[model samples]
Target chain A: MNSAASEPALIGLDWGTSSFRASLIGADGGVLDRLAAPEGIMHVEGGLFEAAFTRLLAPWAGHSDLPVLASGMITSRNGWVETPYVGLPAGGKELARAIATHQTTDGRTVHFITGLASETDGAPDVMRGEETQIVGAVAMDTSDGCFVMPGTHSKWVEVSEGRITRFATYMTGDVFAALRDHTILKALMQDAPFHDEGFRLGVASGLSAGSELLHRLFHVRSMPLFDKIPAGASADYLSGMLIGAEIAGGSAGKANRGPVTIIGRDDLADRYETALGIAGLTTRRAEPDIVARGHFTIAKAAGVIA
Target chain B: MNSAASEPALIGLDWGTSSFRASLIGADGGVLDRLAAPEGIMHVEGGLFEAAFTRLLAPWAGHSDLPVLASGMITSRNGWVETPYVGLPAGGKELARAIATHQTTDGRTVHFITGLASETDGAPDVMRGEETQIVGAVAMDTSDGCFVMPGTHSKWVEVSEGRITRFATYMTGDVFAALRDHTILKALMQDAPFHDEGFRLGVASGLSAGSELLHRLFHVRSMPLFDKIPAGASADYLSGMLIGAEIAGGSAGKANRGPVTIIGRDDLADRYETALGIAGLTTRRAEPDIVARGHFTIAKAAGVIA
Candidate 1:
């Protein structure tokens, strides 16, 4: 084992449903190197996560003594192992304690971080690794602001001072899938990724005529009936309807007085920015690998590294 | 056939998915008698509708000498026959022509009404028998306003003078079935129909939190993960989310500048009124049998009966 004086060693693992990435970082918070594996917690069956991880890191077998800190669905109920949920206003300590301690066949310290939870108007919402990203985002900023992390389940979190005040999760992913696959809106869309014109139109239609979104939604099916708008615009129309409604309702704009900073890919950020602009709000953008950065900040705060 | 001196004889049929009711009215507009049958268009094998109708209406077999008017699924593509759409601001004469004029197994005068089509913002919407209801509603008052005829596919129609201006259908019943049967919200509801409290709460939740409705919806599954919001409450919550969102979005609410009237059973009318109240509108009650009244109005308009 490396002494703290020599260079404390720690490994940070970002594991999710479909992929896994791990980094070996020095005590100074510098990455030595990283390894990626397609075999995520979601891909592996229960009870085999340990073996999968062992094979994944076999090349780095020499670092058997490093402390392992993991995040993502690897800790979900159906993941490698189920970790207990930590209640609202959760932080690093809560996450660390909720982590399940494990010993690999080669004898390594394995700790999976806990997910975050909060009640919105008495309804409960939870997030796993996103909490790490929030921690990093908060660490990067001195003032309080809302964080919008766009993904399958887009989360908008509020932070006051250093604590996670509250958060809400939108099934933007599910809606995307549903509209694209299950709804008649699918017919009106091109196979290509959403065009900006379509996206903009959708956002505009959603907001300007937002109150009628639901009623007008059926027209996506009825349009071809009366020989009017092309069916291909249905997908765009639906996207605009959902996102426009989100923006009009202030979901992606600001939080209690804090500005919004969206953390995602460039195109998505642009779309969101466009949506927010339409809803009359200015927003900032951040491109750091949020979960990895969040985990790094957590490891640093815990004094195990950095 | 016996006839009244001033009015022409007319037959009005309210054929629906599950049942059929035909009223034979006199030239002076009195119901000569009613005929009921189980052979809803839904039960028939499409082309067999003519044969099925002939078998059921053997008594009025001679009515072939009179003008017979029909409403309902009989005009849908899969019903008796598909009638070409009549453009908006128009009525059902072409629809009458489109009807399969069967020289029945025995001859009969059969006239089917055509569905109405209107376009808004480039999207087209259509309504079938509801045009008859709008015709009926207008007969009561020729001034411009909105008229809502609620059912499985609830139609909110706008009319001015004698023309149907615009219309939209809300899948209110479909949503009700989906929420009550397939989702976690069902856990929160009882099989038996409950009263006004939950219904009113559902409407209010939909109105204020309508934008977050989808976000709140995902929690119907996650609620049991942390706190104990009854499964039944989830049902109520979902119902509220949909109906409430509709109220906020004005699904059945009309854009016309006149009083709103709801037509349905007492319980349903109360729910709509409550939803309308939440939307900041007042409503008057109309007879639930708008179809029958619609039949009478169309007959009068066509001079088939006065």
Candidate 2:
């Protein structure tokens, strides 16, 4: 490797569905420089995933043959190399063993981390990039409980003894987007910054709404008619209700219930924390860069770099 | 009025979002003939509702000065005339009292039967067309209990002493369509006939899915991965889950524990009946043409005809 063996230990990359994020990690597991590109797994066309990624990483051409640790949708079926999801009770070690390796034309050794496949008897559940975040979060705090990572497909992971035992996936953001963009509720909501009181009320309503999520959602439109819920607050309220329902259902049978460790951006993580709080659950937030931290942890375990 | 003063008794119309259905009702409450046109409320454009409806009814020009009774979206804000929703505990007589009369230049007195508005303390819930169906269903069965009308916006209505007591609305069909057309699960589904066993299992799963509908729904994608639910069966299972959740939420705290009277088409009614049966509830379907039957009963209550 061109760089000193211990100088910059790894190049960590998190390529998700919509965006590609990378960070240069030093031997001390600290991020040196963060890089990003619009070339997410989905946006990269054809099978030119490696070429596209290489071009994006051309800025660091001098660091030859630097071992890279990649996670997220990059290891998915549509990604460069389809890495098999390791079944859970997975941890950093399980993820490290299943790392799929590839070489770019520029001779960079890229080690990709596979995700966790939930051991569900009924439905086959899986998560690609979130497992890395789990490792990163667990590494930071050795406590075991449920961890929530909210996004388009928010994940509720069960962590026990530093291992991801089981989990559930909720399409909270996807359903909300579909309803807003495609359904009539779109017309009912107004553009307004999220108000917490409205969100709390929404959580209350959603929980009381029972199992009939489809039925309760209609109230978003009707509440405005009687001026019960203002139009501007409707979006936040809807968000709260969906998130509330997700928490109620996801936490149904979990034996290890305590303060959930949330790993995400500020806005989404805060929303989930708020809802979880309202649902009588406590939560602690890991650092925002858990995905990168995860990559660093997995890469170290795989010996991709010293 | 023309046509022997009592021959065409009353002209009944069911104008909803997608289409306009009209029936010529004789004094004996029998439909002499049914006429349908694609000119639904959405199609009647440019503030020419009366004009468009007049052109469609030009075939019945002979019945000049005949009083017309209209229900459904044609009575909403976007319809020809915006009628108010009567509060719940409303029945045939209450609906008759709230009829908004209009003058269609075809020399006809159009008596529009307004819908019932649910008394939701948190949201202003209302249904324009389903109330007519409830009126008709109650007239036929006279057994006072809860009535469910499954459609684009499925409704659960309560009745007591032959009067509509209260109700709630679920966007079951709307959400189903949104997922089928807008969500990723659409790719995993196919155009297959409704499978009863699959639907039953779905209902069981949905009801038992507890509150985490947002999470359980993701299993629709994964179930096939584990060979738990087939690709074709996924659609039926998803449908069952949504419908089951609706029943669980809608039926909560209802005083009337008797068998629900479902007023809908055969397919939807049967699916609901199956789900309800699995939930340990009994159901009996009302006549298929509850909307038409409702309009007829309302027309008579309004004294627009004998």
Candidate 3:
């Protein structure tokens, strides 16, 4: 195992509901190679996760004793193992202690990272993959700050002293997508693009509509019919409102005096960054592979690969 | 024409997307008889609104010279004719001034009531059927107050001195239905009933999340999994949140020294009433046929029926 130190550093597996990607990282924390499959945990046929896992990684069976780290929905009750969520205030080193492991029939060891559960006073919240991203985030900046990860389920996380102190999730994307197709505004904007001007206006509207999203959404209908909102701007307006409302809603009570960190693919992160700017809040974009880095960082500190 | 007035006070027709209801009113503005059909403007095939209206009313061809007053989507671009919207601060008197007339083949003139347009400082807002309801509400009580009409597209209207001064639309029911059937929350709430306790909890969450509805919605997913929110309560909780958030967002920026008038069917109005109570606001329920009253009141004031 120690002899593989010069070989590929580690395998980072981000397995979610609809897809899974495996990143081969070098000892220098650089991604050397990667593989992704359409086999998300939801569509993992017949519950043959191990068989699927091995078949997916069959190409690298003989690549030394490289330890595999897994994250995302694959660790849930429906996935391979129901890894109990590690409660709030945990980072890479702390998360390392509660890692779940399994030995493959093909003579290899795989380590699955558990998700994080919040200790918030309102509701019990949890996240599986973002914890890794946040860890990957903390790996770069250990100082205290709030982090925004935009996606289907966008997470607003707070990190202080190397641990994920608290967080919240906003279903911004899903709600916007569904509403676009499901509501009346969908008809007028079926072919509308995300116009920059319209989007900015929507952000402003969303701030005004904050939490009153139901009432606010209809503006997409009235504004257009009123010609106040031009043609092809309804969709952008919807997007802006959702994102703006999300920022207002996600950061409502928090004492966010400083800038927040946003982590996601370039496109999604860019949209959030734009809206954050409109809301007069500053933001820094986290590296795209922050999750992979977190996997590498946390696994290393856990002594799983060393 | 005046002789026919004795036969029937007026015919108040509520024509909308999915259904059309024709109400026969007496000289006293009381509903004498009613007829409903599935031929809403949307389902009316072949654009034969005139033919359909004739065929549907053939059952009472010679009953009276009742000036049929049509409202709702039937006057939109897709309906028989696009009766232009009457601008805001319009009650029955102002609306009457903008009435459009259509001549039927039988030499009868149908009086089409135009929808109301808001002169609000922001975008142009319009409503067809709700305006009639508001007019009717005004007929009953000519005072300053906010009105909540809960439905697929809920209307938050303000009336002063018999005129619909301002109004806003909340797609609360539509959003909830779509989120239930189109989003991830739908998966968790396949059979979620409106649990009373869950509804209360959801209402509170909604008020908290109203400013951040997108952020707060995700709690439906995590709280259930964390065992903090019981199974099957997610849907109800979501309902409460949407309703509660609507109140907060809708009521924001408004000065309400008086109670609101909530109009709708029993179930939705009841839920809204309960939520309004929880939100520390007072609500008075309007009759189910309030729309008819509005139409009749406006038509009488305008001398459409005498």
Candidate 4:
């Protein structure tokens, strides 16, 4: 490996509630190296965040001068620095302007990216790290389309002119986990391979006109009881129903935003893609290393790295 | 208590999965004496249901000759006698005709009232205890209307000519509990007295046209964050949203089924009544002791008692 080609220019950190991931990005927008750990904001005991950060980044100690860009829940009220949320119509430049600087005890500087809040809708919706991912996605594709980030709390963001116009968050994955593991539906669910037919049925049901989710969820229980679907496939069916409902709710009035871009891991992105197809919408998966790319973009806009 | 007026004619047991309620009905179809315990079917150790029943009924051992009628999950597959479910368009007569008898160790016969199933809809739905409650409601009103039984799994039943024709189940309460206690929304919730305004706001949001539940639920977290509602009221807000969604789904096509009869305990029925009223549907509470009344009506229809 050529040392100059692999020289680290910026350290990007995606520090969320349950996991921590850091990337060493080269000046040419390439990933020099990457490291991840389970030490999220919630896991660091005794307010030892600075120590944890320093210890985790010890592998690239030779590149100590590289500017560090931190995002996710790490900037929340319970995190290392509580940054104010940037309102709608925000992107890399806006996030760069609002970036708060934290000085580590070791005389190093860390830039924290603020989250975005959507107040245009009835009730307020907010996202921390996903804003960066959206910025990264916009950087990859300059089109004005919607991005579906499927996760514990799936986000549906609308982007125009390389800035996030508005977005909505659906507790799809979180609710699915709670229902499948804690409710009466758990009795009928068994570990099984992905069932395509069950998922399609679920998506169709979720997207059905005048279908209420509370009623549709009970079908997860009744479907197996009536042998409409085998018990083993109930989990995936439940997944499809939730994802489909999310797409229905997220794309209620924004159907003309063109094809959706799914930004997440392949497994979940694939599920969202299938559910969106079932809902008669097309989708494309975003490139990998979205967080790292977002960090690099924001770092450049903030002038932290030149 | 006059002995003649309190003359026991039948023993009615509303035994369910998590609760056991037994009522002694007099010849005049009035409750003579009642007993309740936490010994639901699941609590009976080692399939010793007969022993538990005998011990629980030991208080009324002097009236042992009175025929006992058991309903609820006591007739389910996991109960003492696994009675098959009776199909739709069933009432007291149908339930009486399908009652299965089990001989206890002491040679006493316990008649288990079967549940009802609805296969008319796309998917199948079954109910064990609520069917008897509906029968009792029909006996009191004798009206062709809709019955909303709100509990862990809320049931909406369409009754015509004193028979349940079709019905649907919504996991409103169960999902509410799961989401409130186990999900990310739990962080913003605080236990407090019911907030009427918060509940009203939730109901209006839930009853909004084209509203999706997954999105509405996120408002429970956002409302507080945005200062639209206090943290203490979030619990009630969540409850109202779920109950309101239930009403939306339950009364979708049956708005003209006359006033909905709420068949449940006072607190839950009150919540359902409020949510239904918010959804522009009138509601009336069912009479207490509906289970005992149902048991007596079925016993008389089956000639188990004069």
**Candidate 3 ranges with C-alpha deviation above 4 Å:** A1-6, A253-256, B1-7, B119-121, B253-256
lDDT of 1 by residue, B240-299 (tens): 566666666654434345577676667666667777777777677764445655677666
First chain TM-score, candidate 3 = 0.93
**Candidate 1 lDDT (Cα, 0 to 1):** 0.66
- Tens-digit lDDT track for model 4 on B1-306? 222556789999999999899998988777888999999999999978999999999999998999999999988778898888899789889998998998988889999899988863477788998888888777766877888888899888998888888888889888998999889988878878889999988887777724367777788888898899998899988888888777777798767767888888788888888888888888888888778888888999899998
Docking class of 4: medium
TM-score of chain A of each: 0.85, 0.93, 0.93, 0.96
lDDT of 1 by residue, A93-155 (tens): 555556677776767777778787777766678887788777666665644677777666678
> Candidate 4, which segments miss by more than 4 Å at Cα?
A1-7, A209-211, A254-256, B1-6, B209-211
lDDT of 3 by residue, B1-306 (tens): 022333467888899988999888778777767889999999999998888898887766765487888888999988888988887688888878888888988787888888877744366667887888888877866666899888888889988877777888889999998888889887789485678888898898887665667877887887787777787888888888899888887776553567888888788888999998888887788766667787788788778877
What are the clashing pairs of model 3?
A136-A294, A211-B210, A249-B212, B136-B294
Q: Which candidate is the best by DockQ?
A: 3
Model 2: per-residue Cα lDDT at residue B109 = 80
Model 4: native contacts recovered, as a fraction? 0.68
- Worst 10-residue lDDT window, candidate 4 chain A: A1-10
TM-score of 3: 0.94
Q: Tell me the lDDT of model 3 at A37.
A: 92
TM-score of chain B of each: 0.82, 0.92, 0.93, 0.96
TM-score of chain B taken alone, candidate 3 = 0.93
Relative to the unseen true structure, what is the C-alpha lDDT of residue B247 in candidate 4, on a scale of 0 to 100? 79
* Each model's lDDT: 0.66, 0.80, 0.82, 0.86
